[model samples]
Target: MTVAADAPPLRRPTRLAYGFGSVADGIKSAAFSTYLLLYFNQVLGVKASVVSTAIALTLLVDAVVDPLIGRMSDLTRSKYGRRHPYIFAAAVPAAFFFGMTWFPPAGLSDFAMGVWIFGFAAFARASMSMYQVPANALGSELTQDYAERSRIYGLRYWFAYAGTFAFAAFALKFFFVATPEYPKGQLNPAGYVPFAITAASLIFISILVCGWGTRSRIPYIRQADEREASPGLLSHFKEMGVAFKNRGFLTVFGFAILKWTAIGLYGATSLYFGTYVYQLSSGQLALLTLDSFVAVCIALPLAPKVTKWFGKRNTSLWMALIGITLGTSPLWLTYFDLFFPPGHPLLLPTLLLIGAVYGTMVALSLMMTAAMLADVVEDDAVTSGKHNAGIYFAASSFATQCASGLGILAAGFVLETSQFPGGVDPALVTEAMTDSLIAHYVPMVMGLWAIGCLIIWFYPIDEAKHLANVERLRAREAEAKARDMQDAPLGAPAR
Candidate 1:
C-alpha cells in the first residue's frame, strides 16, 4: 500500500526495490572512479606524466563546475522535475563516450592523444556529474523521518558498493583478458577499444537500472513547493552558500573528500599490485570480485548494529581505524608469497575480514553522511522559514567532486614517477621498477588512507546532537502547521 509521508522509513520491499538500480549506479561510478586514469596511461598509451597532468587539470575543472551545476539543478524546471530529467538525459551519452574514452586509436602522437583525452574526459566527467550529483542529493530528500533517511541511504550505498566492488573485481579481465593483442599495452589498438566498450556498456546499463527503479518512489518535492522563491540561478547559488555556512555540513564534506581520496589511491595501486607486482594474470585479477563481495556481506547486515553501538560519528571514526590497520596487511603479506606459492597465504581470509569491516564503514559513510547533510538542510529550513533540499544536497555533491579530484590527481602523479612502459618493456617489468613500485609507490598509499583516517578523526556531529536537532525541528514544524490551521481562510484547512 502507498504510505503516509510520516510513516517509519525502513521496509524490506523498498530495500529490495532499491537494490537492483543502486548496484548498477555503483558499477558505473566504480568503473570511472577506479579505472579510468590507469586505462589512459597503460591502455591508451598516454604517458603517465601527461595523463596525470590531464586528469589533475580536469579535476580542477570539475571542482570549478561542480557546485554551480548543483545550483543549476536546484533551479531546473521540466515536466520530469529537477533531478530525473538530467539523469535520464545523461545516461546514453555517458555510456557511449565512456566506452569511447577507453578505445585506443592508432597514429596519434602523445600531444594529439593528450588533447583527445582532455576533450573527451572533460565531457565524460561532465555527463556523469549531470547524473551523480542529483542521485546523491535525492537520497536525503526521499523521506523526512530520521531513521527512514538512514535506511534509504544505507540501502542506496550498500547497493552502490555491491555494484562497484563486484564490477571492480571482474570487469577488467572480463573484457581484456581473453584478448592477447593488448600485451603490447600502452595504447595498443587491441587493448583500448575493447576495454572501453565493456566499461561503457556496464555504465550505461547501470544508469538505466537506476532511472527505471527509482521512478515510482521518488517524489518531485522541488516541484511540489506551494510558494517558490528567488531569481532562479541566483537563488540556487545563494542557497548553496547558505548550506555551506553550516558547520555540520562541512564535516560531511571533509569525510567525503578524505575517504574517497583514500579509496581512489587504493584503486590506482590495486591494478599495479594485481597486474605488475603480484604478477597475477588478468584472469587472476578476477579474484577481486570476491574481495568486494565479502566486504558487502559483512557491511549490509552489520550496518544498523554498528551505528547503534558506536553511533554514526564515532562509528565512522572507528571503522576508518579498523580499515587502516587491517588494510595494511596486504602490503606486508607480499613477503609471504615466498613461503607459499603465488596465492595469498592469508589473502582470502584477510580480505574477507577487511572487506566486511571496510564495507560496513563504506556503507555507513554513505548513509550517515547523507543523513547528516539532510539534517543540515533542515537546520536551514527551521531558521529561514523555507524548505531547501536541493541546494543543501548540491553543495554536498560539490564537496564530493573536490574529494574525487584530489584523489585522481594524487593517483596520476604517483604513477607518473614509476618509469613505466617506454622505460621498461611490457614483456618483463624491471626488478628495479617492481621493487620501486612495491617498496616506494605502493606503501605510500597506505599512508594516504592513514592520513584520511586522521582527517576524518576530527569530523563534527554526534548522535546526541543530531537527535536533539531532530526534536527541535519536529516541534517547530508542528507549531508552523498549527499556525497555518488557525490562520486558514475559510475552506483552506491545514496544509
Candidate 2:
C-alpha cells in the first residue's frame, strides 16, 4: 500500500546517490553521444561508412535486446535490491568494454574491425542498461508529487551537466591534442591511446560512483508470479503489440524519439562547426563547453517554476519555440557577410551569440524532457492494467540510441563527403567549409523539421488526463494485488 503521496520524499543521502547515478550515466553516455563517431573515423582510422555500419548493426540488435533487458530487470530480485544488483554487477564490465571499444588493432580487415567495434559497443550499451532502466523506474515510483519528480530529475540533470562538461571540454582534445607519444603530426592509429585512456578513466570512475553511490537507495519490487504472466514468446509478442497499439503511449514515444534525434544529430555535428568551419582550436572548444556548463547552472533552478506556471505541455512548447529562436541565432549570423566584411570585428559577436544561445537551450530543456516522460508513464499505468515504467524508459532509451547511431552514420558521411582531412591545422578557417557548415546548420536552426517535433510534443497526454489516469491505474493495480493475495493461499495459510 505504498501510495505515491504517502511515500516520504527521498532522503538527502538517497538524493545524492541518485545524483551520482545520473552523473555516471551522463559521463558514460557523453562519450558515446559526442565522440564515438569522431574517435572511430579520425583516431582509429575507420571509414565513415564502416563506423556507421558498426554502430547501426550494434543498435539494430540491441533494439530488441534492450526492451527484453528492461522487462527482465523489472522482473529481477535480490537482497541488495531488484535494480541495484544489476547496476553494481554491470559496472566493471562496462568499464572494460568501453575501453576495448577504442582499442583498434593494426592491419585488421574492416569487417573484423567492424565486428570488434560492434561487440564492445553493444556490451557497453547493455551494461549501462542494467543500471539505467531500474534507476528510471525508481524515479517514477519514488514519489507521487508532480513537482517533486521534476526537482529530482532536474537535480539529476545538474550533475548530468557535470558529465557533459567533462566529456565535452576534454575528451576529444585529450585524444587529438595530448598523448605525449602521438605528438602533433602523428596519424597512425596511435591516436587511439589517449582516447581509450580517457574513455576508460571516465567510465570507470562513473561506474564506481553509480555502483557504490546508489547501493543505499535500494528500493526493490517483487517479481510477478510465473503463472500470471505471458507464458511464451508468442504471448510476449502479443503483449508487446498491445503495448504499442495503445495510441497514447505511441504518441509519447514518438515525441521522445524526435526530441532525442534532434539532440543526437546536434551532438554528432558540433565538431564539424568547431573544427572544420569556424576552425576553433582545442582551447576554443574547451571554452565553448565551459560556456554551456555555466548556462546549465543558470537555467536549472528555473525549469521547475516554469513548468508549474505553464503546465508541462505549454512549458515544453514555449521552451522549444524559444529554444528554436535562441538556438538558431547562429543561423542569423550566416547573413553577417552582407552587413560586414568577412573579417569584421563583429565576428566575435556572432560567435558569442551562438555560444550563449546554445548554452541556454542546452540547460533549459532538461526538466521539460523528464516531465514529459513522467506524463507518458502515468498515462501508461492508467490505461494498461499494469505499470511498466522500465519498459517505457527502455523504449525511450532505444530511440535515443537509434537516433544517435544514425547520426553517427550521417555525420561520418557528411564529413567524409566534405573531404575534410583530420589532424590538419586546427586554425585554418576556410570559406568553403563555412558555407558547408552553414548549409547544415541553417535547416536545423531555422526549425525546419522542428515542426514535426511540435506535432509530436502536443499529443493529447496533458496533466489532468495524467492525474486521472494515475488514480484509475493505481486502483486497478491494487485490486489486482488483492485478487493475487486471495488466490495465493487457496490451500494454505497466509504467511
Which candidate achieves the best lDDT against the true structure?
2
TM-score of 1: 0.84
What Cα-based lDDT does every candidate model obtain? 0.61, 0.63
Candidate 1 residues lying further than 4 Å off, grouped into runs, are 1-19, 75-81, 178-195, 218-235, 333-367, 421-427, 442-444, 483-489, 492-495
Q: Candidate 2 local accuracy as lDDT?
A: 0.63
Model 1, residue pairs in steric clash: 43-187, 44-187, 45-187, 103-193, 169-289, 295-355
Worst 10 residues of 2 by lDDT: 1-10
Candidate 2 residue lDDT tens string, 1-495 = 212223444677666667656665666556675667666665665676777678767787668766765666555554554456667677778678878887767787868888888888888877776667667766676655677777777777777777777566664455456334433322235545775676567665665665566565554333444444444656545555555766655755665566655666666667656555545556566666666667667767777787678776666655666776666555445545543333456654566666666666656565666766766766766656455666777776776667667666655665666666554544564676666656655565345326645665656766677778768766766776566668875676432
lDDT of 1 by residue, 381-445 (tens): 65665455666665665555555656666666666566556333455775566555556545566
TM-score for every candidate vs. truth?
Answer: 0.84, 0.84
Model 2, residue pairs in steric clash: none
